[model samples]
Target chain A: MTVLGWTRHRTNLPSGVRSLHCGDWTILVSDDPSIQTARHRLAAQVSCFDAGLDFLPTAPAQNIAIYDATSFTRTTDLDALWRKLSDRGQFSVAVRMAADQEHRTQDGRSWLKTRQAQRQRQRHCGTMLADIVAHLKLPTTQPRHTENSASCDVLVQRDDTNRVHNAMQHLARLMQGPPDMRLCVTGLWPPFGFVDLTSKTEAAE
Target chain B: MSLALEMATPQDAIRSSDTALVDVVDGLLRHGVVIRGELWLTVADVDLVFLGLDLLLASPDKMRPEGITR
Candidate 1:
């Protein structure tokens, strides 16, 4: 199963380096003179095919992007740290994964009402759903199908709920949610977690 | 596209808020699906660093925001 994942670059990676899939997950490896040395360890006794980082999709629909801020020694306060990042034009990293999927629907109601309104408010949602269905209908479509030499699967992430009972509420929404024309959330998964900013080094090659 | 994506990008109105990043990462860990890979690293440092400490950063509050050079 092909999995999509991502991570943020905490420091300036060496020039010409990208990312790599260490195992089922993606990781960053150096592209220095001993490239093969790094490869030897990562590829050791592995049966899976390694999809180099250059091909990773930065787009949310295509990949699971991650944003980490725990390495900063500048501040211990989460709020202050976030503010510092924001002041310096780096705040976007935090929202990189869910930003595109979140919707703002105008309704005289609470969060639930706003979320419910998204289905009716956006014209493209239907179109997108149709496109997904069309993609799935392809005779070659399979959970592990590789199209254009790239793995394909139903990409889903959370942007619907953020309250105390987010899980239950989301599960409820999933149970009674509107019928999606073509997308399927369940199938083979690659876990997408191994992908980190370091993989970018592999892409540079 | 994932909704957390837009929230993570900085252009969103909520980007500047203190909890926006927290909320986005939280949403990702709780709802985001890593189609493949054994372990997904969501922390910025671990993703960039060649280490296996992502689990430690799962608690968003514990992660410190490192500055970007460019």
Candidate 2:
């Protein structure tokens, strides 16, 4: 029996290092020297494979791209990138915040500050999503369950390629939103969460 | 040809609105398939401090091995 699970573990990560994984690609953001070495090694490994290993593959099948959000200074910059990616096909993107002074000094006060920060982050995400939806001219209805809070995850279906491109463009624009935001994007594939291993095995036979 | 878009060099837009940054962070962290792992620090090849928190976001479907499903 194949069982699939998602696990989250928290560690005392060195300041400034944040990691985002999309599909088989992993993006680590940090100024830490050791972490930088790891990132370089990973990049080399991906290049060496040429076809990208099972997890991180090369273009055509899989394309792993990196961008420094700090450099993106305009909405146009984001729009151009979005158009480029949309011209392609499947993709996914993720954004994160740099671990700064407030994150480094974890104390009682910081805990409260973190909560406030989370609220602010959610609001920002909402604004970005709203902007994207408006740009794509898609329905702006909030998912029923998450009506109160911002819906962090935006799933773009591939039924119609044009619609998919609009969704992807909107997401790309979101990545260009803020300097502190660390973003990573990847091409989409079947989700492990909903896959049935037993059914797969039976089908193969 | 790489479809990857080249992010322009830092300019006025780099300093986007605070709300924008917050939203980016929220979406990146909150939405996605998160995988957690740990890193053990070594000093002079000697294993020392253990860093227990790390997250990697990806498609949840691809991360699962055959035997583990949740």
* Best-performing candidate as measured by lDDT: 2
- Going through the candidates in order, state the TM-score of chain A alone for each one: 0.19, 0.33
* Candidate models: Cα lDDT each: 0.26, 0.33
DockQ of 1: 0.02
**Which 10-residue window in model 2 chain B sums to the lowest lDDT?**
B1-10
Q: Summarize candidate 2's per-residue lDDT along A175-198 as a digit string, tens digits.
A: 465655533333332121111122
Q: Pick out the ten consecutive residues of candidate 1 chain B with the lowest summed lDDT.
A: B61-70
Runs in model 1 with CA error above 4 Å? A1-15, A18-116, A122-127, A130-205, B1-70
CAPRI class assigned to model 2: incorrect
Candidate 1 docking category? incorrect
Span of ten consecutive residues with least summed lDDT in model 2 chain A: A1-10
Tens-place lDDT digits, model 1, residues A73-98? 11223233223222111111110111
Scored against the true structure, residue A37 in model 1 reaches a CA lDDT of 25
TM-score of predicted chain B versus true chain B for each candidate? 0.21, 0.25
